[model samples]
Target: METGTLYIIGTPIGNLEDITPRAIRILNEVDVVFCEDTRVTRRLFERHGITTHLKSLNARTESLKIAEVLDLLKEGQSVAYVSDAGTPTVSDPGSQLVGSVRNEGIKIEVIPGPSALTAALSITGVPASEFLFLGFLPHKKGRQTQLKEIAQTKRTVVLYESTHRIIKLLNELEEHIGERKVCIARELTKIYEEVLCGTPLELRGILENDPQKQKGEFVVVISQ
Candidate 1:
């Protein structure tokens, strides 16, 4: 019997319209859809009228669930994996699952969709021929070291940050990079989409003054 295929589907980060036609077809046809959050995926499914079976696959229980997924694939059940938003395995938990399936000789396919990092970079007017995606920085032990590395990188650096910690990370960048040009993209592709560009210190002041602006996820782009 042939092994099943694993589809890494990328859902919209903010707006539902960002999903492609092919992605919608795959989501509806797949045997099962594994998502980080069932409720969140349910909303997307409901909007598209897709009634495919849903399963929870997140970092917390990925290890325990991998065996079950592998078994299903071995039985020739096709599966589609999607993160709560954006692409999976890009700061998401689908990497291990994908790797495990591949190691078992199962096929894997990526269904690319809206990504905050790529979307923000495209509109920032910044050169992205060479770039580094740092995802979310470490919170504690190696946080300073990671920031230092980002500061020294020659290529453009992109990072994902929570609204709550954006100010703190900006302060750290100001101290480490010192006057580097930065772009902060928030609520990307959504109704409140915003892109603020300036020196680290300048952006810091803007964010501080408008507390309401810091209510959504952020993508920080730093130019070398």
Candidate 2:
């Protein structure tokens, strides 16, 4: 019997139209789909008219359910793994499962699609020949240490910030990197999508004055 293949699919970050046709076909072709949030992924599948059943798989539940994935793969079942948004395994839950499948010599295919990191970078106009990508800062512990590091790094820096912490993150960026040019992108590919360019202090004021601007996923790009 042929060994089953594991598909690492990249779903849209915001707009459902961002998903590639190949990604859509694979999601439908796979025997099962595992994602970060079924409710969120369901919207994407529903938008594309895909009826594949979704199973919950995230950072918290990865360990508990990875064995189940392995068992299915060993049984020659083609499986697909996706994140709540963007590509899988970039600050998502597919790292362990991908590695596990690779160690067992199972086939793995990456279905390239949307990525927030690349989306923000494309619109930032910041020189990113090479840049440091810090996915998300630690909420409390060592947060300052990371900020300090960001202050000194010569390369461009990219970081993801949530709506709730955007203000706090901007304050830290201002405190540490003072006057460094920063580009903030929110709601990529969505109706309210916006890209703001200014110093952290300046952008913070903009977000504060307009409550609507501070209400989505954010990608912060710092110039060298």
Candidate 3:
């Protein structure tokens, strides 16, 4: 009997229309889906009228439930994993599960879809032929060191930030990275989606006054 495949699928970051037909098909076909938020995933499933079994597998539940997932895969049952948004294991859970499956010789496949990283870069035109993606920066400890490192890198830098700390991060960038050209994209693929281009300080000012601009997810890019 053939071992089942592990599908690391990508879902839309915000816009439901961004979901690919292939991703939809895989969701319907998989025996089970391990997702970060069952409620969020349910909306997507309902949109497409899919009823695949969903099991919560976030940071809290992953360690406890991964053994069960591995058992199912070992039983020759194909399984799918998706984060609440974007691709699994990209600043999300599933890294440990993927690593474990790989070690066990299970077949793993990636079903690509919308990513804030790629979406922001697509519009920035910031000479990112070579760049480093730091995902989300550390929240507290060692945050300054990482900011310093981002400032010094010759290549472009890309990372994600939440609404609560977007302004704070831009302020930190102004102090650490100085007048480097920056692009800040928020609410990608949504009605209110907007991208701001300027120095870190300028972007900080824009986000500070406009409470609406600071309401959604953010992707920040800094030029070399």
What range of 10 consecutive residues in model 3 has the weakest lDDT sum? 204-213
Q: Note the Cα lDDT for every prediction shown.
A: 0.92, 0.93, 0.91
Query: What TM-score would candidate 3 get against the native?
Result: 0.97
The residue-by-residue lDDT of candidate 3 on 147-168, one tens digit each, is: 9999889999999999999989
Candidate 2 vs candidate 3: the lDDT winner is: 2
User: Candidate 1 overall Cα lDDT vs. reference?
Assistant: 0.92
Deviation from native of the Cα of residue 201 in model 1, angstroms = 1.1
Total clashes in model 2, counting residue pairs 3 or more apart in sequence or in different chains: 0
RMSD of 2: 0.9
In angstroms, how far off is 218's CA in candidate 2? Answer: 0.2
Predicted candidate 2 versus true structure: per-residue lDDT over 92-143, tens digit per residue: 7889989989999999999999999999999989998899999899998988
Candidate 3 or 1, higher lDDT: 1
Model 1: per-residue Cα lDDT over 31-69, one tens digit each: 999999999999999999999999999999898899989
Off by over 4 Å in 1: none
